[model samples]
Target chain A: MQLRLETKQLNYSIDGFDILKGISINVEDKKMVGIIGPNGSGKTTLLKHIYRALPSEYKKVFIDGRDIENYTHKQSARKLTVVRQENSSDFDFTVEKMVLLGRAPYRRSFESYTKEDMQFADDALNAIGMEAYRYRSFNTLSGGEKQRVLIARSLAQQADIFVLDEPTNHLDVHYQWSIMALIRRLNTTVLGVYHNLNLAAQFCDELYVLCSGHVVASGTPKEVLTPKLMAEVFGVEADIMQLKNGRLQLVINEAMTAQ
Target chain B: MIKNRVATPNGYGDIDKSNISSVKKHRYIASFILLPFLYVLSVFLACAFGSSTVPIEKVILVLKQELFGIVSEIITPSDIYIVWNLRFPRALLALAAGGGLAVAGAAMQSVTKNVMADPYVLGISSGALAFVSIGFMIGGVMLNTKWFLPLMAFGGALFALLMVFAVGGFSNTSSPARLVLSGLAVSITLNAVGQYGIYNAKNISSSNAVVSWMMGSLGGSRWADVWIPILSSLLGTAFFLLNARSFDLMTLGDETAISLGVNTRHLKRLAFIVVAMMCGVSVASCGIIGLVGFMVPHIVRFITGTEHRRVFPLSFLVGGIFLVCMDILARIILAPNELPIGILTALCGGPYFVWLLRKNKGRG
Candidate 1:
């Protein structure tokens, strides 16, 4: 699809306070880009805007050079998918049925599901290693399993672009790395928000660091994850090193105490 | 929260280690065998037992004559008419009302993502009450018209439905929390108006009729009352079934729905109108039957799981059967002078509802 995602001069506000101010970025096709920031620094807000969960006030968000507003919801959904961090619902739907909702973009009202839709849903379940738990009720799933199922649902949409907010949040160590590996293996254009600097540096090809709704740094992990940037942006002292394979890594001396 | 946890079924070292797939298959097979038999039995039992308590043979003869127009040697004209025009219509009415109320309840619960949601949640009953009061005030002039009650009730329901949506701020994107709050606010207001009308009426006869109607009795159901509710319920049921997929998606919440390409705002509007129409017709014909809407859906959920495809159809059948049984109880409990069906439903529904609330209190 030669997919590309771009946000130009994006600005957002909630309750008269700016959340994402003058944010601009371009993500090339087939790369995993990580967006990392402190709490309330607008990572989730930016992802929400891209996924159309929150309306953009002043910005241009384009997918493959086409204006986002020009595409209908179905059209956009068919072209892009999203997996959000927050999971809150009071429903009692089974896991398979909930995952099948991922196919909704392709079906019309009163339309019966086709065999291909079932295939896609089955494939998604297989991809996330949730086939064994397909019949479990959603309320019964663990947090990490729920997150993986959410990812599986987005994959079932067959979208070229993915915008995930904290995709690794609530996962154990093994599943966290495995999920990142799967996202990379899919080779879809990905914009992910992360809290773990180590995971972001290990997985993402490029990084965008935001401080107070402004992009403070944007480059490869080696260039942007410097000790100076960490101290300046996050008020933390960190050591940066390059392994023999030539990958950058960060080792934090200590997590800053809460004020 | 963590320390006070109950002994868990799926916890470490629990013996119920059956996989999810096997558990689901077992549940599906059990329900498949159980529900249909129950539905048929409920229908026959509902028809057989009433205040008059006729024998099965007489009931069959009466039913055959009423349905096929065959002149039977055994059954008399009064028995035939009572069975056909009176009891049979009431049974059918019970089925329609039960199924309609249950489907409406399930749809509302899905759309609102609130367990307490039902046809009455959005002032449908208050609207019907107001219309019934208005029909009484207009008296003989309105009474002469055949469709007056249904039309007035539908109009009032539509008004209340619109009022809730308007107050809820149903924009291109609607919020379910706001929709529920708006419904609560409007229902309280309209109910006050209904109370005032009851207080000011000169004759208690008409007011008493309205009160008993609100308590939902099937005793007065005639063939004429049957047609409107039947037609409206069928239409509403068809609408809900057609959009059952959308209702399933709605429970995933608005953000997930948007991701799946559903315009929730439009769906919400349509569901509100259809549920109001069904309940409005029900109230017009049979007063305000409560609890069938709430209990029937939950009972179906216990058996069918939460896939809307199964839940919707199962709820429809289960709801119909539930009301038929409740109606039979109402008729025979006091024999000859039946109690209101609503009273019995409420008596059962209230305790069950409390237990449900308590069970699910912190799970969410």
Candidate 2:
């Protein structure tokens, strides 16, 4: 029973300033959809509305064709998991302990994790190549390591949909590839905010290009990643090329001159 | 250009699970035994060392004599009365105050996600004392009553905290800044009200007693008054222990917690209520002890890690022991003229806090 994520005519405003207006997006079960936008494009805000972090009107967002408001937070969380942008904290806990907290949604308030829960956490860490760092302090990890651990923690939830926002931010190129590969291999329905268009084109089955709080373009990356769309949406004169391996690479020629 | 992945899933590694589990288990066991042992020893030492200075051996005999009704002529009746009536109840009340405040502090830190937050930061003590001032103004010189002032003060504490919540909370959840500002506003207003109530009470002696009470004291700990703090701490501890997992979730911030199926607003609300109730009860019992609520929990987290399960209970024990020792110093420092326990804790905790900030300043 794979869940499909859909939003229709969603509008969000803060203090009379609109953040998102009439944004609609849909991703089929087990597919990956990427949201690519420049700063203040409302990509993260749209993700928040889908995940129930920020409230939206009833029936505006749906999972599995049912209104998202129909599901309780617990039910929605069990179906969807999120990897947020920031996970840094001064407080220290072991990597295993940090991952084990993913079971929080499944356990009762007074309940402790079971052996099976531990096994799931172990597997999640293993999937992220962090099994060796299980006992390591989470706060001491590099940015990439912390992001991987956070993804592992999200994996421990075993939800049907994974929502991520700029998961590769601050990571070196190697970690960025590995983390994206890990998420791709999971084969779950993913709705993510991606800052890198090359990675978005490479991994996402579909793309939604947001500019100025609106979805300016939405379709297959080949259909949407035109030179004109790049100039209009990103204000960058781009040299978008396809490699022998059939992956797209986007290179910025320069910022547009005033003329 | 496509590149080979830097780190692929190794499937499953042979985890040295036993080492981590054993290390964690050992620390937990050590903390459980060590904290209680320290608390009991401190209680005994604190109960025995005073103006008359009952010996440890006599303190044990007095306990045996009084608790089991084993009449022993080897110990003087005056010593028994001092331990049974004066020091034992005082020590217990100190334990209650320290333990409750520490646990509440731990909860508040996680709840607010601010390491600098204290038990009384939300104006619970100020609000409680403000309400009790009504009793003082109306009845001249009634500080020594058994339960009236505490009950009234508890009411005031709840009212003040609720007002803070109302002011700061939006929709469901509250920001730490809003809560702190609301608390500061409410605290100033309540303190003004209390001052006005006390100064206009028409009796000089009553004014003096009210002034001392506002400064906070453990001198009035009677067996009758002990039950409120004891039961309040016990109940509050139970509530906190149940929500210990939620507390840890919340410290990850509201978005993370909410994503994990935790209703962060509800968690914040629960935190405000439980912390306010625990602090309200403790302040009502011992006027207003300051340092333990902020210091003990901070130290406990430094020792035992950030998990609230250990942080809450360990802080309770550590806090109780700390306050008991502080009270002992209060009694022996000036001998007959005892400084208020709050003054001693502030004097001691102030320096420690300064060092903590200096040490952690580099991290900032």
Candidate 3:
């Protein structure tokens, strides 16, 4: 296994309040790694540092053993792509044009997208089963359809790594599964922040459970999702079950009462 | 493979990909070729109609004579003077001011990510008007200098933009609401300063001149005054066209733009400077022409969509034609006395702006 992305003791604070305290995580090549935590546990904050949206210390993050700070924004974009839930815009563009914007990192100022670039966009839309909607206005699409189009955009980037921040937020159950499945099929290094523990358990090869800006436990889903850890970290009473299909399922029964 | 069972097939099924390409090509043709032709026709018609109407045939003869030195036996010196000197330069100034304001508005809206942003609303125009008012208070000698007024106006506009950026925070952290609010604050303060300067003017005539200029008129446009607005509008439009892709990405929000490889900070700073220059020159050419900036970009966007490549050039031409038509109406509406172009634009734009606010209320 090769390490594709690693964050070493990442620390971030705002106005004397710590958001991420010496957080560390590793994502290997072609693996889907999930981060799960309660709200305000800093899952999104950690992802921000990984994606360079929030600046990180020079030596804190690395991609393929090279410091992320060494790459210009364009260079880093060619190496990694991000798909976020907040992809909505006030303006509208055709679905095809929206996907074509993924080629921005590869293009120079005033340079039009080439035929080859257009093909990449088309192929991405097809892969996401959205070829029929290519001419549709992006903002006019439903939530699920818009998420699919955004995924296709990430595909068009042709990067080796994908960082998704709550990509299935506000999506229906069907869309959540379908979007997660689509991402799983990419066979790339994926770092995802997921709210649904079951989905994270089923799709992620490994899971990191965050509580109060600390990685309290991390291992295979079976190892990390024990009832005791759930009660302690999530303040919930949960029963872990093994389904006949060889999938792990968590049934969260009730919130733990405060002492 | 995940089954493609998500969305039900709709009318869009019949629209093939090739059809989209053809439609885009048509848009390109309409934007680049047809719009330019329409602009030329509008300029010609504007030359023909004014307080003293010249026939279209005579306007063409003057143009032909001036460009090709083809002397016409039917042409009079007054016809030559009206078509070439008076109406022609005024029309050109109107064209340049309109196009510049529209382009500046588009850029400002994109960079700020607010639909209501324009040079006038953002205090750039107020800054120029304020500086010009102060120049008036300094008496006629300073106003007589060729470059003094525009230079002062540019300085004031730039100062106001910087102040807005400072108050709004030029970084990605600044919200669109913050930027607009700061712009309004700066605009109101500068407008008050301009009013105070006018109130203290030495003569009533100089004060009246300032008032009329503030209301915006192309009545003072000369050939020498035409070049600054023309050159600035062209340069600003060119700079924006080249960065259209970046502008498109910017509309997606700051984090997304950065993730897509756009240097948002650098682009925003450069765009603000360009917009300031464009707005300053337009204001200097013809006072504070309100609402052309806010109105024209919206109209162009409705026609051509939000792609800046199409929107910028089309807005340039369409704005030029729209203002030329407005100026013609201004001339004929009062016959010999001219109505301020700014008043007309405000009358037209105010209602549309209200409608837009209602439309956007849900989104906000």
| Per-prediction CA RMSD (Å) | 5.5, 5.3, 3.6
- Mind sharing the TM-score for model 3? 0.91
Ranked by lDDT, the better of candidates 2 and 3 is: 3
Candidates 1 onward: DockQ, in order: 0.38, 0.34, 0.42
Ranked by lDDT, the better of candidates 1 and 2 is: 2
lDDT of 1 by residue, A1-259 (tens): 3549989989988789998889998888898899998888888888877877777553388888888878777888898887765355666665566677788788875677788888888899888777756656677677777888888888888887888777677789887888888888898899989998889999888999998899989998888998888888887888998999887778889766656
Cα lDDT, model 1, residue A103:
82
Model 2's TM-score against the true structure: 0.88
lDDT (tens digit, per residue) of candidate 3 on B1-364: 2222234357545444324434665677777777888899989989998888899999999999998999998999999999998999999998888988898888888777777888887888998878867876774776777677777787778888888887863455665567667888999999998888778876556555667778888887878889888988999999999998888888787778888888787898888878878888887778888888888988877666677877787878888988998999988899888998889988998898789878877753
Native contacts present in each candidate (fraction): 0.53, 0.49, 0.53
Off by over 4 Å in 1: A1-3, A8-11, A14-18, A56-59, A69-72, A86-90, A93-95, A108-114, A210-217, A226-245, A250-259, B1-44, B121-124, B127-189, B201-205
lDDT of 2 at A256: 85
Best by lDDT: 3
After superposition, candidate 3 runs with Cα above 4 Å error: B1-8, B11-28, B134-148, B162-182, B201-205
Model 1's CAPRI class?
A: acceptable
**Candidate 2 ranges with C-alpha deviation above 4 Å:** A1-3, A257-259, B1-24, B73-77, B121-124, B138-194, B362-364
Interface RMSD of each: 6.5, 6.5, 4.5
- DockQ of candidate model 2: 0.34
lDDT of 2 by residue, A199-227 (tens): 89999989998887888999988889988
Chain A TM-scores of all predicted models: 0.92, 0.96, 0.98
